[model samples]
Each structure stands twice: as C-alpha cells, then as structure tokens.
Target: MAGEGFRSALEQADDRIVAGRAMDGDVAAFAVLVRRYTPMMRAYTQRMLNASADVDDIVQETFVTAWQRFSELDDPGKVKSWLMRIVSRKAVDRIRALRPVLDVDDIEQEAPAHSAPARVVEARAGIEALGAALQELPAAQRECWVLREMGGYSYEEIAEELEISVSTARGLLARARKFMIVRMEAWR
Candidate 1:
C-alpha cells in the first residue's frame, strides 16, 4: 500500500517539471507524460471515432506529434489539455480521410455475461444506447460534443481546435445535447 501510494504521488508530481525535463530531452519524463495521459487520450479518441481499429493509431500519433513539438508547448501545466487537443485533431483527420461508413461494431452481439447484476446490465445498455445516439449526430456536432464533454475542453478551445467561433461551438454542443436527450428518452 505504501509503495502504491508512493507511485501515485510520483505520477501526480508537477506537470511543469516533468514537461520541462521532457523538453530538455529526458526520455523518461516523456514516458511519464505518456503514462499519465494515454488512458484519457485513448478514451477520448475512442469516443470521437466510430471505428475501433484506428483509435490506437490516432492516440499513438498524438504522442508522436507532442514529442516532435515539445518545445512549442507554452504551458506545461496544461499538458493534459494539450495532449487531448492533439488527439482530437488526429481523430478528426482520420475521420475525414476515411469515407463515412456505418460502424456495425457497436451493434454486434455481446458475449454472455454470467451472474451480472441488473444495475450493471442496465448501465451497459444505457451506455450502448448513448453510443448509438452519438453515432447518429452530425460529424461537426459530434466532434464538438466529444471535445467539450469527453475531452474536457472549454468552448474557446473547442472553437479554436475546430476552427469556428465560440458561439458556433456553443450551438453545436447545445444541439448535440438536445439530440442526445431526445434519443436517450427512448431508453428510459
């Protein structure tokens, strides 16, 4: 327990120091950043993209870009958001590159679960329904929602990343929320 606590503390150390070391060519520091943010990046990219195969590639590319441009990071404290922005951009690029295809992976049959609680089953169903509803949103609105809600980016950041005005980002998010609410109502 003590060792786990120590490891957690190390991982939670100041991002600025770690990022500074990474900028100065410390491979281990960069590894720390990767370990800290990879899970969130993977999750964000997975949500942004419909296809599962390309999520890993997009996340890997995000880190690669961050590494190449380490010196350009103005604020190391914002590394988490910076990494998320990179993942968002990469996921968008991948989506644009691939012709839109209806992803049936989300609709595929799931393996049987033994002795799962009713709440767990219901929660899983809700999540699946939400994912299906997200898939139905327009690409622009979907990206806005993922960046704002899942990526935890602000409206200004979303606007800058998506190359639109702040009001547009707000509108997109609003529409997405409304659509999701309506779609999810059927699940209740």
Candidate 2:
C-alpha cells in the first residue's frame, strides 16, 4: 500500500516537473509530457467524439495545439486537466464541423480482456444500452454529461468549453442524467 502511494506521488511530481520544463521550452520535457498524456487524451477524445470524427486525428491535433500553447497554461500541476480540456475542445470542434452522428454499429464495444465470455457479452450489452441512451440526448446535453461524467471536468470547465453559463451546464447535466436514468431503467 505504501509503495503504491509513493509511486502515485512520484508520478504527480514528475507531471508537474515536466510541464514546467515544457513551458520553459525544453523539447525533451515536452516529449515526456506527450508520452505521459497521449493515451489519456486519446481515450478522452474517443469518448467525446462520435464515430464520424477520427479520434486519432483529433488527439494529434490536440497535442499540436498544446505544444503551441504550453506557455499559456496557468498551472503546471494541472497538466492532465489542461490536456483533457484541449482534447475536449478538439473533439467538440470536430463534432461541430462534421455535423455527423455515429451510426449505432460504430459505437465501440469494450470488454475486460480476461472476463468470461458471458461477462464480455453482458458488458457489451450495457455499453450498447448506454450508447443508445446517450444518443437520445440533445447534443448540448450529451456533451455536458460526457464532459462532467466521463471526462471528469468541472462545471466551470464544461461551461467554458461549451461557451455556455455555468448554470446552463448544470441544467443540461441534470436533464441528461434524468433522461439517461429513465431510459436505462426500461432496459433493466
């Protein structure tokens, strides 16, 4: 338990150190930041985007933008949040630009690698149900819910990204959650 805590602390310290160095124009430090955050950014982007938007391309564009604006980041200790915000923005931009919704089949099916086949099947069914429920939401509500729930963003962050008021973000999230719960209840 102690070792796990120590390792987590070390990772946090390293993230802060690398972010500061990157802001100071250290290419090597910036590379370390990229390696550390790419997977997380990619995953976040994937969840934020519909099937029409290419997750890989959006994540790459996010990193490029981050490189250009590293010095603009206010808090080095919050590099993970910063990176996620970039991904969220990039994904939103793509969604707006493309204006295409993902077909139901395009939703990714995920299962725990070592799970039993029945468990995998059950997980996939749940994912499908959730995806269907999300699709029922208005775009704005869906975006707000995904950012707050899946991406772990605060209300202020969601409002800023979506260019809406904090109260609006909150309302949208509430409505979205209510709708999802009602829809999922029928599935059970």
Q: Which of the numbered candidates is closest to the native, going by highest lDDT?
A: 1
lDDT of each: 0.87, 0.85
* Tens digit per residue, CA lDDT, model 2, 1-188: 99678545545666778789788987767777777888888778777774445998988888899999987899898988998988898888888887867898988977757597987888889999999889989999999999999999999999999999999999999999999889899567
TM-score of each: 0.48, 0.45
Candidate 2 pairs with clashing backbones: none
Give every collision pair in model 1: none
List candidate 1 segments past 4 Å from native. 1-10, 100-188
Candidate 2 vs. true structure, TM-score: 0.45
Residues 152-181, candidate 1, lDDT per residue (tens digit)?
999999999999999999999999989988
Report the error of model 2 at residue 69, Å: 0.8
Best by TM-score: 1
